[model samples]
Target chain A: MSNKAKHWEKTKGQMIITMILWFFFGYVIFMFGENINSASFLGYPLAYYMCAQGSIIAFVVILFWSAGRQEKIDEEFGFTEKEDD
Target chain B: MFKGKFIDNLPKIYGTYTGGFLVFIILMAIAESAGMTKETIGILFVAFTVCIYAFIGWLSRTVQVDAYYVAGRQVPTVFNGMATAADWMSGASFVAMAGGIYFGGYTYMAFLVGWTGGYILVSSLLAPYLRKFGCYTVPDFIGTRYGGNFARFCAVCVLTLASFTYVTAQINATGTIAARALQIPFELGVWVGLISILLCSMLGGMRAVTWTQVAQYIVLIIAYLIPIFWISNKGGYGLFPHLMLGEEVARLGELEAQFGLVKNSAAAVKEAGVPGGLKSISLPHSEVPAGGMAAWKFISLALCMMVGTASLPHILMRYFTTPSVKAARKSVCWSLFFIALLYTSAPMLATLSKLSLMDPTLPTGIIGKEISAVMAIDWVSAWTAQKQAFIADFNGDGILQLNEWFMRGDVVVLSTPEIAGLPYVISGLVAAGGMAAAMSTADGLILAIANALSHDIYFKIIDPKADVRKRLIVARSLLVVIGAFGAYIASMRITGILGAVAWAFDFAMSGLFFPLVLGVWWKRATRQGAIAGMITGLGSGTAYLIYVYPKFMGNPAWLGIDHLRFGIIGASVCLIVMVVVSLMTPAPDSATQKMIDEVRIPSGKTILGKQH
Candidate 1:
């Protein structure tokens, strides 16, 4: 593939990730009104616990993970610039 | 001669923090002497809170000017999250939210939804682009992006509207919390918060705010969580379940037996007209399921929280400090995580306290049928020496009846430790955390306000030829002036502290958030459209707030709408005007287009894959 094509693929990937996050966000809101705890794992109310606690934890985790990934992607695509500019 | 030069300047720069610490120590001593448990423990917690503040000061001093302003554009994602948590969790989040949850139930759940979820929108849509541009303030982005001075002025108007009123309220909250927790006059609390804010904010800008906020986040979360855990352990319930049901049931049963429900099955109180049994309005319910509003209240509140989180200036400014678009995006996620720890716990605290109210076991337990009001009281007095303060035996009745909880709704979080009989050490920590939350946000706002005035207004507009050094001096002077103004307004008790902060969020969402969001994400957004939207948002939001504020606050009606729901109305109008106006105006110039393209490229690289 040409370099232009590679850039296209990277841009496509970023868009896809952004869309996926938006979808998950919508899903969380739809489930918000329900009893979060009743959707349980190991007899714990999973949704209840998550809405109350877990969602925030997941949010934090994803932020760091995605940030690291984006930086790597930028570097791989030769998007990195030196400060001398 | 060397000592004289050093000594003369040192007092202005360093003693602010030192003076802040000395004052904090004195405040702690007073709290200990007045009502703090085991004086040594109370003093120890005060020492801990002060130590955290001192460490933040040390960190700020070590970083360079760029770092001091924007964390050297190198802060890691998680650490930034902690700092953002500190930034966002103002007095409103740390103090009033718990009580809101405690009192309002499902209706209040909107707070968590709006606040936590807004980060997703910010990280995905805005933070990366803002960071890529490398601007100092939000206005910088608008001015450079649009190539106009007018845009900068518009930005300043919106920022000032959002922050000035909001900061004053934070000061009010800090004053109230300090006075209540430390046993000082309310004015003293305001002064303490103000001085601390001046110390950190004036010395270093966003960089100082970041480290201090990080420290505050730790103090706040520790202060918030420890009390909840302590309460849960003693009360014998998991955090959420007890809060939801336990206390509610206990209080209900106590109320029922006191009113002679068993003796006369179909009876109402003789004069008060309240029903005798389970349907009593005279007592506090576990939840206000339909707290006197329709479904619209719920929807509007949800909208407010959702939009408000994205709109705050202090929170928005954090994006500028990151090294790249990616870092900013990650920081939002980190922020959500830090916020989640406490935000999630708040409702649970409310639920547990409610459940404890309904628990029909001991002091707050069920009343026997034979125990008329009088005998029930004697039994409670004998059974539990004097721990049950919420119970009152009115009408000379023997039974322990539900009176007011002696705590106002605002005091719910602050009083939780004492209510659960936790050590004074923890209460002191919570007090410090509340102050930190208030001060950090206030300092950030003051910095933003001062920056807009000195850099954007005076230096940029009034004195266009002023040097960078002069502009910096002007910024420092403005910080002191604006900081003092916020403190003075806070002392006046303008409104409920939390409500005022929330109001600022509302204003920002309507006037600022839409313009910025559309400007960054959509190519079609034009200057004319942006200006029109800002006018509609700022105009109606201010008008609605001023007009209907009285009615919403339980004053006489003006057009009959509640103040709480007024924000959504403003936001809706703003969005409508923006869309309509954008369709009519011409697209941005090629220069503006080029600027956009530049920001769109990832940091540390050219989009064309060549060295610049």
Candidate 2:
């Protein structure tokens, strides 16, 4: 495979892993969080708490981390362009 | 702050806008104290705020193609984030989403999760690449990636359908707010909304939409937070509603048990003279779904929503306005942060509103009272007068049973201030905020549809040599026509706001999701594959929705999915079709492959990737 294709493969793998992380935090926790409802967090039901606040916090973290990491990936791969602005 | 031109002016512009808003609020207060009726105050408030937006649109009017098409491609990350958040939160989200949570309970988290998770998809998979592609519209990317007008035309078709469906709902929402605030007929109110939408979008295109949306975001977030904060304080949660909602949940559980007692008592039923009324009484508060099927429905709905959020045309267009690919990625994070401010607060607002309505101290509760006494509370009487809520002692017991109290969920958020006994102006402010949410979204959707027509069809296909002035004329005129059509559909009131929005999301996801995602990621994806995938996906989704869904709603689960979750089936079909078609067909030629590689890079000086 060409170098572009190899880079594509690596980035694709990373993207999939990132997506799986989101799926776990968004879907898995949402589906099974109720199993932990007996537990409480900071005066709130754990399941409801995760659904309302925790999941969003997790999403923000994942997005920022992925964005920061992708910049590094691009730079390492020599794909970064000079800032046009 | 940095010393760049736009950056240097940002703080001054914000200051002026903020000062203007504060002065308007002070004037409103004086009018309220000078004995203006609440209805008059509400109408004046909406009118003043909407006119301000229209005036901003007039001020930012642009004839240049670049400014009209993508706001000159210079929006900073933070302001673009604000604009995007305003554009994303529609009337359904601002008004009905919390109401859905109030009525549907834990299951409604599908909306919150789906929408926010979709942003993850956008930030990771779509936004940066699309920004690097540096095109004007989604169709532009598709056309260039696939190297054909056919693919672009197909994209335009899907964009129009999806955006039209979404815009109609927004117009409907705008009409609802106007009708309630002005005490006018719903039909007339829709015309009022259409006029404001046209005024904002027709003159300046996306440039006007972006700046006005920033203003709308500020108004909307403030309007949303105020009543919720008031409720949180009143509920003894101090200011942190998220942390303190567990106690409210526990208290609500106790109230549910008390209502359940009334539901099961045969003596009470016979005394009330309404047999089988217990079920309706207990049904509204029973939010938890039983067994595995409920979980399946939740996951499917959430999945549909997440994918749908990523696929919507108007939203994708917002990313094109950012200054750089990195700014595009950063804007997604900022959009999520701003949107979370409302989403996290919505459930808390719903819970508090439910508690307030059921509080035994209020006349709204299920207590024994004379009819006159029960009707004495101003908010209760106000809702009943509007026919939004009703109380009837069906059993002749002279006591309101839980079943006897019925309210349309749409009014829950709108009536929260009155229900909580806050001042009338707060309700007026909420109305203004709702209008802002509706108008901001409407402005974006109308421009999306019109841009597809003018840029994709007129300039690119019909008149490739059309001057910038000619293109601007076409875009502006199309905005007027499309705005009127959307308003007419909304006035017809074919569906509720949330239902229409859900359908729009599903439609957009089914048709556009696979093609748009593959276009950027897979270099081998051919024009034929995209066209085939979009057609089959859209065709099958629409066919199922039109032919099978109504019949299936009452039947057992079809493959563990419901009508609302049909986007999953559509998306699955598109993925299979696209992969098969692309593998069977020849890959895109060398030039297209080169362009795809260029899009993959975060920042590159590429000939094809210049801003249009």
Candidate 3:
């Protein structure tokens, strides 16, 4: 396979994984949160805590990680721009 | 220090600007302490802020097409991130999202989740690729990728429709802020909003809007964070509300249970008293639906919001202002961080505000001396006098039932300071921040619509050889016309702020999401498929919204999905249509395939055929 095609496939894989993680963090947690309302974290219902603040923290972390990972992939494939000093 | 003078001087310039703002705030505080009428203080605060934004707009004025179109492609990643956040967090976000949370409870998490999650798509799927394409507007991408004016025209139509809807909501938000702050009619407030937005955007285009948005971001974040911190500390949660919010949630939960009991009993008694009386009002947070169809509704709404955020034209336009593809990617992360700062704090603010409102010491429904006492509690009295909130004895038992207390969702953030008994100046600051949010978003939306009209419709289709000067004039003139139309729609107040914003997102996602995503990823996506997809998706979505859902399918939604989730259906139809049609049609030519390859690469140096 061409190097470009291989890189594309890898990027797609990474993206799918990231998206699945997001779906779990965002959707699954919210959808099933009520099931865990009895569970307490930091003095609140676990589900309610997720809705209030946990999911947001998860979102920020996911983005930062995804961004960092994407930058690494770009560098590996020589897709990033070179900085001039 | 020896390289570029502009880069060297950046911090100094920003420092001076920050210092000047602080001085101005101090002077304003002094004037307020000198006993200026609150109305006059509000007017001055708004006027001063708007003038500063206008001055920034004037400073960045440019006749060059490059600068006018994309801010000369020179904005640093961090500043662009700030600007993008300011542009993304509209009045709905700044003023209404928390209020929605306060009123709608867990169900409204659809907004918080959807909006923040959408940034992941932008960073991972859209921004870097679009930056690689190096386009001026979203239509430029469609026009170039599909290789025709027909595709361009369709994209322009979608852009205009989506942006017009979004801009009207923002103007409505601005009008709401102005009307409340200035004690004027909403119609007049909208007119004031239009003039200020036009002044900032009509002169310098994206260049001006970008700088002004960065400044606005500072004002808004400070405005948003201050009251939350104050209230959080007052609630004994300390300064870090996010860390301590769980306790607040627990307390709120207990209060809710107590109120729920009172509410149920009140409803039962009221039903026995008056057989046909309206339903007793429950605590605002008590209506969050749970399990089964409600969960499906939440999922669908969240999905629609996610895609809609990714697809909105004005938002996508913000990425084009960044200097490079790498910068674009970095900026998305920053935008999410900045936006999350406000999004997470909103729930804390809502909880704090709820606690204050439900204080047991406050006089409830008594008519004589107790009513006077309640009226004397600044926040309660202020909102009551304005008819934004009220307390009444519906059951006439002479005691205040928790269910009898009602507050408008939109005023929670605005009345936070008054509720906490913070000085009146902070109230003014929040108003200015709300105005900043509304104005910043409005400017971006207006520019998007005008750019589509002037660049896609006028320059590309009408006069291909139009000079730079003529193009700039057209863009400016279109801004004025669109601004006036937006103001008129806002004055009509057709829908609530969040409702209008939701429709804008749904429409954008329904029509543009599939096409834009496919354009970047699927090389075989034909022009015919794109055009068909755009038309079918938008047409069907609008049809369902206007006719089918409202007229034919009433009561329970089809498959537990309501009209608000129409984007899901529209997007599904679009993806199917595009893929099926593309498979049947001949593939795009080799050159078009090559252009797609370049778009996939992250480097900015990859040139496609020719510059526009």
Candidate 4:
């Protein structure tokens, strides 16, 4: 594959993984918000606690982590945007 | 403080500004304790904040073409993130989000998820590529990618309509804040807000907007957090409420029971709602498969918002100011991180703030109590005087029930401090923050519409040889014209700010999302195919919006998509038509194909050349 396509290949691979994690934290858990309510932690239902804080925090981490992976992909395929001196 | 380079001196300038703001808060609090009138404190809060924004706008004022449109393409990532966060936190997120979560329960989180989830798509799919494409507007992207003026014009029309719908809503929020803060009429307050909004953007354009948004974010976050901190501490949940509010979620339920606010599903709402009776609390008109629990009713609203967030022209425009493609990508992470600061706290505020109102032991807790007694309370009487809240006793039992009470969601965040009986200064600070939220968003939306019209429609299309000074003149003029028009529409009260915002998101995504995404990813996407897809998508979405509207036929939703979720169908049809049409037509020229590859690579200098 050409360098451009290789960069895209690695980026796409990471993107698929990121999307799954994003979906799981954002949707799948929230969809089952009630069924998981009985499993209480910290004096709150699991679902409520998760929705209130955990998932949002998860989103932040996922964003940064995805950026880090993209940097690696960019470097591996020689696609890094060089800062002008 | 260093004066040679503003960018290098950013910390010094903003640090002093922040310190000065803290001192101002201290003075406001002291003045409140020293027996200052509430109205004086409120006006001072607003005047001080707006003056600060206007000062920044004046300081950044420029006639330079690049700076006017894209902040000279030199904003730092973190500052851009804060600005984007402020831009994202409109009247909806600042004021209505907690209320949405408060009233709708778990299902309302779809918005929180969808909005935040959208940045992931932005970071990976759009922002970096758009930054690499080096365009000033979304329509510029459409025009270049699709290779035609007609496609760009269609994109421009939908952008203006959707963004105008959005701008009017923000102005409505500003009017609400100004009306309460200044004791002026709502319509009059709208004109006041419009002038301040225009002052922030008209002078320096996006450069002014960028710095002003950063300042606004600071004021808003402080205002948002202080009340939550006070409520949590007062309620024994501690300062870090989300971490320790273990049973407080359950406390909300206990409080709900005590207030007799019970309803299992949308079916209950139907029985409880009086025909043509005044009801402003937003209950979803439809249900989802989350057990028909009503909490899950608007799950699709979240899904559409995600796609909509990715497509919004104003939001996409923010990335262009970043220093590099990578910076633009990381800025999405920062945007969500800053946004998360407020969003994660919204549910906490939702439960705790409701508890402040519902806990019968609390002095302001009025539900399930006698109507006359509740009326006598100062905050209750005050909000009721402004027509933001209502209480009626229907059962002749002398006690208030859930059915006899109503409150506008827009007022909940503003009124929470008063309801919780905090210092009047905190309420003033919140009023300042609310205005900041509204004005900050209005600035961005106005600039987006004005820039697209001035840059793409005026400069590029109508007069390609237009100079930098002429373009700036046209842009600023459009800002004033549009701002006044928006204020007029806002005074009419077309719908609640949140409802208008939802429609804006639906319209934005309906027409723009598939074309934008496919433009970058699929080089086969032809100009004709894209133009056809945009028109059909937007047209179908508008048709669905009308069909479901109560004043119209009120048709039942097809495939369970309501008016707010019409993007789901619009985008689906757009993708299918785009794919089918692209294959049936000839490919774009090699130049356009190569331009696609250049954006995808994300390295080296931008494909488009420097500004004149």
Per-model lDDT: 0.63, 0.81, 0.80, 0.83
| Best prediction by DockQ | 2
TM-score of each: 0.78, 0.93, 0.93, 0.95
Q: What would the per-residue lDDT of candidate 1 be over residues B377-456, giving only the tens digit for each residue?
A: 44233322423122323344454334312234555676566545565556676777777787777777887788777766
TM-score winner between candidates 1 and 2: 2
| CA displacement after TM-score superposition, residue B384 of candidate 2 (Å) | 1.8
Instruction: Encode model 4's per-residue lDDT on A29-64: one tens digit a residue.
Output: 766765776787777777766766777788889999
lDDT of 1 at B357: 46
Error of 3 at A21 (Å): 1.4
User: Second chain of candidate 3: TM-score?
Assistant: 0.93
Instruction: List ranges where model 4 is wrong by over 4 Å.
Output: B258-298
Lowest-sum lDDT 10-residue window in model 3 chain B: B361-370
How would you encode candidate 4's per-residue C-alpha lDDT over B219-284 as one tens digit per residue?
A: 999989989989888767776887877666777666555555444344544555432213432332
Q: Which candidate number maximizes TM-score? A: 4
User: For candidate 2, lDDT tens digit of each residue in B79-187?
Assistant: 8888999999999889987888776667777788888889999988898888888789989888888878998998899889888989999999899899889889999
DockQ, per-model, please?
A: 0.30, 0.58, 0.55, 0.53
* Tens-digit lDDT track of model 3 for B1-612: 234665456556666776777677678778888997888878777888888999988988998888898887778887888899999999988888777787667777677888888888887789888878878889888888887999999888888888898999999988888887777898999998888898888789999999899889888998899889987776577678777766667666666676563454655545544222222335344234667777777777878888998998888889987777888888888898898889988888877777666656433222222444665766667666776876666567555556665567777788778767776777888899999999999999999999988999899899999998999999999999999999998888677677668888888987899889999888899999999899898888877776535555555556865677778777888888889988889999999998888787776474532246
**Deviation in Å, model 3, residue B211 alpha carbon:** 0.3
Which residue segments of model 1 deviate by more than 4 Å?
A1-51, A54-85, B1-44, B51-55, B58-68, B238-296, B362-406, B551-561, B605-612
Q: Give the clashing pairs for model 2.
A: A81-B603, B272-B395
In candidate 2, stretches whose alpha carbon ends up further than 4 angstroms from where it belongs are: A1-10, B1-7, B261-288, B361-372, B551-557, B606-612
For model 1, how big is the iRMS in angstroms? 5.7
